[model samples]
Target: MYLSSVSRPASADPPTPGRPGRRFALVSGNVVALGTVSLITDVSAEMVAAVLPLYLVLGLQLSPVAFGVLDGVHAGATALLRVVGGFVADRFRRRKLVAGVGYALSAVAKLGLLLAGRSVPVIGAVIAVDRLGKGVRTAPRDALITLSTPPESLGRAFGVHRAMDSFGAFLGPLAALAVLLAVGQSYDAVFVTSFCIAALAVVILVLFVRERPEGGPPDTPDGPKVSVREALGLLRDRPARRLVLAAALLGLATIGDGFVYLLLQRREDLGLRWFPLLAVGTSLAYLVLAAPLGVLADRVGRLPVVIGGYLALGATYLLLSGPVHGWPVLALTLALYGGFYAATDGVLIALAGPVLPARVRTTGIALVQSGQAMAYLVSSVLFGLAWQLWGPENAVRAAAVAVAVVLLGTVPLLASPSRLVTRKVPR
Candidate 1:
């Protein structure tokens, strides 16, 4: 498939001077293959995500605090495993294999959800298993993209991948809605269909995605083994440390998509059936903006783009809490939320890709991702508490303030030009 078609070597090739299209033109076939895998996987994942909030809050009658805990667990359940997955992939030079395992685990977890029924603990456990699969797969998958693409075009590469991924996200909720409508609100059918689609994604990964693209990062059989100490040593680098800290801070400022959508649904008094469409709105905006913003990040510098994303996030939170009513608020909030994701998600990883050593690249990415996930867990819980204590409006407003504070704090951490420079970690 795509693996055989790309004849060009994958070594970092600086964009030709004055070539306007060089940035995206440099994105490799391997990146596209990986993106396809992510696209399929997201379709499977987002199907569950689209309906989960309503299932837990409305069907199960969970309080905000209980829902918060489950949501936090959903995000952070595999934080430690991400590092393990990354280290294993790096050590064995089997990124594709590790990623496949994670994918399979998540595909099976879909069935677990079917078995869990209405039991909260069981549902939480299933969610954790699903998230664990995500945690395991994410870093290695992103590392593969970085390894496949040139440093100069990393932004475009990740952007292209995320855009494809968002396209699937855009489709997923619609698919779920269709399933629900067809089967008379049968979540089981959605789960089964999701598993089938997820299984297909795994098959695609095994067949189409190359373990190592031609001229990609060195992972020769004779190369020195990647060690735990070496993985930990990534933090010793100033730029890498700052990047991870910045990522965690950014995560801390953010709340879950479920919360945002739920808040909107409450404020707008949207019907239960229309809930899934809210995610579709966000994903549609994400699909449209992801690639353009990525290209912009490469051109203007990633930090500014990332900062702007957080600004969009703050605006989204404000809109949720603000007095603005009717469809305009919903449209603007969803757009800004989607823009926030488009601006930050892949771009931050692309920014970090150039800073870490090739051998520990997956581990480095995992560390960054793990930190962010852990913080996201805390953020979700805190936001939940805020909602319970201060009510939704005050809670969302506080979240907006938090975003502003974190953005200000992040600027100084990332302000040093040297903080983003590529560095070699000694053996």
Candidate 2:
């Protein structure tokens, strides 16, 4: 088995009684480097995400159902590849290299958008390619964080990392808006610029991020080899199985960001130019709350934090369909939406990190993520169908109800006593 020590800075102070030592000790240099990479990469990814709904729905004149299919594809196109990437990273012990390849692929896909030139199928293909990169990178990248951080600090470490990532998400829409205004609403310019930024992120990953921290277990030929059977066997582990099931349930309750923003736009009659800013509001809230909520997860419990996040999601959907009008609804919905992401995104992974063994940690993370992605694909399509059959208002209200039902169902799965224990993989 591959064993590793948590990477802490030499300057880190030991925890003292009555001191805020946990706060200071939670993040390490390796985590910061990873966060920086995510920060830049999200800026590139979100720029496209911010504008794509409008481009597809209004610019391309696609129906809600078509957009939903495309959106679902965008989210889940490479779900299986998440497992492949994780297995590759674990088997080769080349996490950074795998993640870098994923980033580079996403960067190149931005240029693919330029070549697609308004063909719906071609655009869908490009979006799938872009999401493939994300699916490929996410597990290995998250595993790197889990490997480097102490089990106790996983929540805070992921929190800090996500906050930085959310900062990039926060800036991306503004950047897109600026480019669109400067270039006279030319999406090609936005695509070109996004490509450049994503390329820069790949460079940073290659230069700054380490495959594993120093003084940890070296990647050696003699280490126990990971196997496909072992990866599949993760489901036999009760905690891992529950986590994956819970993740899928949560994912099934979520409609994609595009639908939420588009609904907000239609309800408010917002101008086309203001649409990108809707993402900014959510990202801003996520950026501010991610770290704090992460720390809260560590102090309280991961399950509660995750449950709270789902509650926020439920509230956000209700606000969308509620009778309340004007800026208050928008602001509240965005804030709740952001809180939903902040509380759940990294925290759920952190919840899993401790329970998984070191030997196939990446594979375990990939399973959880893949389950969610696959379920999200279904949710998006169903939501689109609902929007078409029943109006947006009725569809959103149904979604809120679904969220509540899922939350009630998931609580028992995640709250089981066997779910949170840290596993000690034999060496």
- lDDT by residue (294-344, candidate 2, tens digit) is 888876777778989999999999999988879988998999999999999
Instruction: Judging by lDDT against the true structure, name the best candidate.
Output: 2
Range of the 10 consecutive residues with the lowest summed lDDT in candidate 2: 1-10
Model 2 residue pairs with clashes: none
Report residue 408 deviation for candidate 2 (angstroms): 1.5
Off by over 4 Å in 2: 1-23, 215-222, 422-427
Residue 137, candidate 1: Cα error in Å is 0.5
lDDT of 2: 0.85
Residue pairs with backbone overlap in model 1: none
User: How far is 112's C-alpha from truth in model 2 (Å)?
Assistant: 0.4
- Candidate 2 matches the true fold with a TM-score of 0.92
